[model samples]
Target: MRHFSSSATRTSRHRVIGALTAALLCAAGATVPAAAHSPATPAPPAGAPAGSGLALTPPMGFNNWNSTHCRAEFNESMVKGIADIFVEKGLKEAGYEYVNLDDCWAKTQRNADGKLEADPVRFPNGIKAVADYVHSKGLKLGIYTSAGTRTCDSVGIPGALGHEFSDAQQFADWGVDYLKYDNCNNLGVDAKERYTTMRDALAATGRPIVYSICEWGENKPWEWAAELGNLWRTTGDINDSWNSMLSIMKQNLPLAAAAGPGHWNDPDMLEVGNGGMTDTEYRTHFSMWSVMAAPLLIGADLRKATPETFDILSNHEVIAVDQDPLGKQGTVLSSDGGRWVVAKEMQDGSRAVALFNETGSAQRISTTATEAGLPEATAYSVRDLWTHTTTNTAGGLSATVPAHGTVLLRVAADKHWAAYPPAVELALDGSALVEAGRTAKLTTRVTDLGRTPATKVSAALTGPAGWQVRADSATTAAALATGRTLATRWQVTAPAGTATGTYDLTLTTRYRAPSGKQVRSSVPFQAHVVVAPPAGGGYLSDLPRLSASNGYGPVEKDTSNGESAAGDGKPLTIGGQVFTKGLGAHASSSVEYYAGGACSTVTASVGVDDETGAKGSVAFEIWSDGTKAASTGVLTNDMAAQSVSADVSGAQVVRLVVTDGGDGVDYDHADWGDLRITC
Candidate 1:
């Protein structure tokens, strides 16, 4: 239900581009200021009838927006196929129940009777037929429409603004069970009045259709939408990237007081299985959404989803947290640097704790059960949702989470503590970059945190095919007593012709539990394969980066930081100075290039891009190998371009990083202008 224009071609009946652009510009940057609402935001009046009984918890479903996005493949067959996959892939059993259709489902114009009509070619059987099919699968059907004269699709299908009653009646007649009303092309109408009209119209139909207001939190919906819709969006659209997901999460995590049964704060849809992030990141995405009690509407194409995607979607433990009858949104307990600790109260007196690491390196995050709001007890049961393993902890809960990963734990007091396994933690320490044909040594430390000892503990490391991996020291031990650790070292060798990029390795650790069962934990490890650049001076943009991650869109080669769309940037400009060659990136971004141990120095002019108009703040750092070689403490848009030079002799990889300057990443567009490297 995002309010962004799609690439669908418009019909002659639609308004002109100039008019649409004017409307879009008016709605641009409509996000409500943070001061407008907070965790203390009051709830709706009691006995409010809007969405009184529907969506008692956050909705769990699939919306065909992020994946197909009005493409040719987004047809009746695809919707039916998704419903079928819901049933066939255990998603239905896991508590997902809705099959939602997004924009471009309707025709450009209404029918002769002034009623909305489904696209004939895309839905030959009409929406009613698709709704019937979805209902037959024991799932609800959700349809999308804007509150203006046209939908978000560039083709401009009929909206429900003036025809609210008629469209609501038509959807009711079609057996639609959910409605995602978006905000686009509203013609400057008041958001509340526009959405209220549709709400009243839907209620008059005498059906139980769930109303989801997609106003992008422009008017502080959390302060007023609880009495009007079942769920209201609290942020803009979500893209399938870590920074996009993290930024949205930060925006939505502060409005916990506005969410509850039948009324919730929607942070947009799930981006799992979208392929933009690693599986570890997807797990964190799912875990955080569940902890925050956000709608679990999947945004991936189910017909082509991988097994890993299905696994993340169908995790019953995580899903239960999202669907908890308590309906309390998670609140941030602590946040320092890039580490976050969030906790949610469940219906049965349990607390769901998420130790999230947003940094670019592995970190040890810890939180006590008492700090998580659990009552004092002799022992607590710590359940790892992703690993599906339960362990007994005296009081402390901790994990060494990977970069952009989460350790989701459900902590609760348990009387039968001896029945569960002892908690064993794993941590990996070693270099992250290795030259081709060279070897690197990595160490894994296993510790027993439970009261009892873990027997026959062992660890092993495995790399990609054609790469050599072996244990350099003892990998097994008789037993690891409480608070004791066993460290093992492994030697890894990349092939001589290994590609210059990041490679994944798995570190698996196993131990025998008190119940005589084997417990296994597998952690993902990344190693960069570097080959120095050609022995010459050249622009840094000319070389292929080993890895790149931007906060907004893809890092640009030679332009200013633009919007969320790739290749939309202009000439790179900093403090009114334009550069023809540089990297345009957003805050909290990183790009690594293989220096091949040949580059002697790297230089650049770094500053906040003027495109943000004195509204951005960021700090730039250069990392040579694993050490910081140079840094610009903090740069703002008001400052001129500052020169940065880093000594990079014998460095295998050079990394350029830009971080948000203590504040959030709200307009932190940055530019690395005239960057050059000398070898």
Candidate 2:
């Protein structure tokens, strides 16, 4: 993060800085050679005389890594060739800067003086000359480095860990404008410390270098990455394919609130210039990232530019949203798997919303209404950022977005969004599950998505199976939709004696709409109340949950499809018959299987009372959809659990059923969460 005055000597220096130590160093005088650290050479402040247009804004330029990096016997001429054209055709004027050399650009190590130098094989004229050329064109220069012992390219060299500040000085000496700090073999307490270390190192360089920390959010560094560097990687590297881009974007949007002007969520560089995806998908990629406020680090060869690529990158309206002086990141307001609605507040108090569909199949996303906590009704002149046209619609809100695409509009509260008030307000990350004999309570408020506040509205709560209702929200005609959303809550208190199980609570929004239809919107409320297993509970209480950290293998075929009571329960009723015929896709048997017996096979607790019944053992069964298995085994006090591996593959034709393994009131609640199959 170091920089030298134009009149200073050029000497590359590298050194190791201690972890977490803040280093303070800046270039002499007011000419801050580097500005906003735009992944390129950090641009000096906007009007620092060393910056070009949009310098205060994040740079929109292309790199070589995503698509083609140093291929085809290319060298400095290849990189400089692109910059020359960028300047010649006024691409810089169009707001694209920082022709960067991502990887394979640096040497194994610095010279005897501890200077970090570029590989002579690639940039023969040196990074300084390239920086000068880039500067001549009114653009900025950028370089890359590794945070681990090596880079993604796997070169055997020391990383910035023990040598952060020193490397910062070296970059400044080389006239480096931007430093792309990568994480290859990095190991630390977590992502925060690693990023924090480099951030301080760059600062120590005394040069205004943008520290772009690439850790891929292994430990959620975005939570506080901004404090350490200008940008931090939020996900793994993205490819030029639609699926890859979509996956990366999916996880980034939720963390949008973490980004701002100086610090951004880096999506491991842009794949816009990459040829793997179609032009349409590329545009969608750009649109999604811009809306989410992710760093627009172009990852394609800028030298061989495409018209379509230029169009996607140069959309003024989209770019406006990305570079909005407000510097706010867009976040998901509502989301389903197929479609999602996201919003970002703009400087003019206007809110931009994008309804995006990410499915291969056609999907429809509708924005019913919303509220932004405004006092009075406001009108908005809704304009589509993609089509660049005004949408003529009645009422002050909502839109239906297309499939595999998005509908981004500047929702002017006073214009179109004015008439709406926020109605449905959802709180907590999700529903709270009360264990059996426990209580569940959560609080949330709703406001108007429009200018008019939701004054008085009613809410109703309903549930399935056993639900103890506490209050009828509708009795108060309580505030229905705030900001157009209904302020409502559903709380169910299951006394210690309540049955142990998961119950679904349905929340229905009832409100007197401006249209006077008394709209009722239903949202599913889920609650899991697992009765504390009456003291010493759970068959395998110490077993790990099947999660990313603890993956479980699939079921192996070693048990029997027999007719005996080895299952310990009466003959399992199959297809309404006592005989185990027509069970599963098999010709016979819902019979008991064994694995954990003697050394039981997958054993379970059938909670049934073995105290009074002769037919009290739970049996295993399965129903499959192609290959997805829905295996069910009984849980009872009598026959705790029995495993039967009846080959449930293509399990669609099978139905896992549990029955008659308990005496009346035998506490036969079949409780199972970690139903893992070990291969």
Candidate 3:
């Protein structure tokens, strides 16, 4: 579903937005240039610069790729239904205007008249009919095509690579208001020239159309597309996963200076309600996208979206930051201690700050007004956008952010007095299951939830008698700011003769708050230790493991997915450590196992290994005697290894199959670690 950026010259040329704006104004009423061939270009006529005044702000809308992925079910009726949801669900009122058709909307070939035709069966009333419907509903219609001979999806329909003018005219005649021009099968054509040709064609039609260049950031369009397009895709497609979402945000946030006003950097689409991440992560996703001024296109099934999704998508105050008249993308002020702080300069001289906790546990985050680009030591009033609560910050704001969450605030100068004390919370990230008499590691992350910084931060761990916890049971940490996190790991080992059962763990953290007061907090948790069975079988990890004997290829050590392919091999990382011993297979591909039979269950932790967009997308399935027993939901980059189990009693053979999740097999590098069959 994505075409990542290929190798290109690392050019660092920079062009200001004012220059591009001036170029558009200068090109008004100019004659468009003709292309080199029949499909390459069209005759010149009335023209202007590309995408001028069309995307003064990032365009908000709904795209259909993440939801259906060019299935046969995509048709005019589906478009109409989504258009209705745009209005009926109040999305249109929330500023989501464009109802875009991504791919597979056209016929395999042009009609006898040499015109692109809508699929007769799927779009009986034609593209114009759907456009009319969206317009009537007070929304714009967006269509998709490619700069290559075939679209990225290659749905059999020809792309607009060589038919710039003709396709532009057809789209204009159909009343299309936006075009998502993709880059697929382009045969090494210069991306800039190819897209510019269509830009001129659209402008020559004397119609206002938003030109969205979908080069997948391969050519660094952010540096050159300002005058050629309204918005350009800065990365590959986005999937519904926490890792994918956060990775995209991390990549786009650094390119903020490349965005402003009309020319925006698109980070694909939103995956808020796709069930890939928690609601907390969705808020962070929306908050990050808004702060970066990225397009806010919803990519979920709107007809059945939950209220939580609607609330996240329809947050007006957050939307205001995205649509700010200043049109400046936010900048990251700090990214230390698992806390990411972003500050966007508003038109009214105020700053919109987003404090994000990227840890897996709740953390206290704080920053002073000066650190957040506001006047230092000056009284300021803080408004929490999500909570809609206004409070006075003596110098800055602070709050305790949940795991993978964010706190959005609008800070302005005020002569008020309010002091929020620093607070600390602790969370542990490690396996709940531990091997008796063996050593295990657990990471403790402490977060500050007050407005001021906490100093003298240290932690200690205590467990059952005869148990040993090593590696800095008393560890010191750097000063922690509000919303910031400090992580420490402690190794715990039980006595060799200790009983196998659940044991309690206590983590006591001692710290000095901003007020110079010492405080201590205790967190009680549990870890289970299961001893190896005295007889026949144990976890495969305890014994020498064998690779696939059939239905697979070479088994390389430390390889998870595959190599140089969608199912390419990549290593598995757990708790930030690479687990070299595991199983890796491609979709429709399997690894056989003979770890003995008569076992009560087969268990293995599964997930994708790579972080390269959809190439790491896959579903892990376990099969016994040609029948499915256990499977996991589609795992992307963000999802960590999850335990997948199935009954295998009386079984002699079992296999792990990594299949393309009902879609064509692409990035199906599946990982199954600690694979075992136990009685």
TM-score of each: 0.83, 0.55, 0.63
lDDT of model number 3: 0.69
* Global lDDT of each candidate: 0.81, 0.50, 0.69
The sequence of per-residue lDDT tens digits that candidate 3 reaches over residues 1-679 is 2322111111101111111110000111112111112212332344444667667778889988888777877888888999998888777777788899988888888888778999888899999999999989878899998887766553457888788999999998998888999876676778888988998888877677888998867778899998788899887556676645665676588789899877999998999898878898899999989898888888988877899999999887788778776788999988764578899987777788998976543455677777877766445666667865454455545655665789888776644323423545566763233566788777877776545677888888788888888754437776887667777778888877766555777777888755566777665555555454325565553543222321122333455544423334556653344666666554444454442344667787777655344355668777664468888887776776788998876554455666556643434455667666776
Over 4 Å off in model 1, which ranges? 1-49, 334-337, 359-363, 465-473, 531-547, 563-568, 592-604, 610-639, 642-667, 675-679
- Evaluated against the true structure, the overall lDDT of model 2 is 0.50
Task: List candidate 2 stretches off by more than 4 Å.
Answer: 1-59, 70-74, 88-90, 187-194, 368-379, 396-400, 414-679
Off by over 4 Å in 3: 1-48, 415-679
Model 1 over residues 130-237: C-alpha lDDT tens digits?
A: 998998998889999988888877786878889998988898899888899988788878888888888888777777778899987878899999878999999777
TM-score of 2: 0.55
Candidate order, TM-score descending = 1, 3, 2
Which residue window of length 10 is worst by lDDT in model 2? Answer: 547-556
lDDT per residue, candidate 2, 51-139, as tens digits? 22223445466566765553543467877877887777655655567677777777787689876677788878888888888777777
Error of 1 at 18 (Å): 6.5
Clashes of each: 2, 95, 21
Residue 234's lDDT within candidate 1 is 91
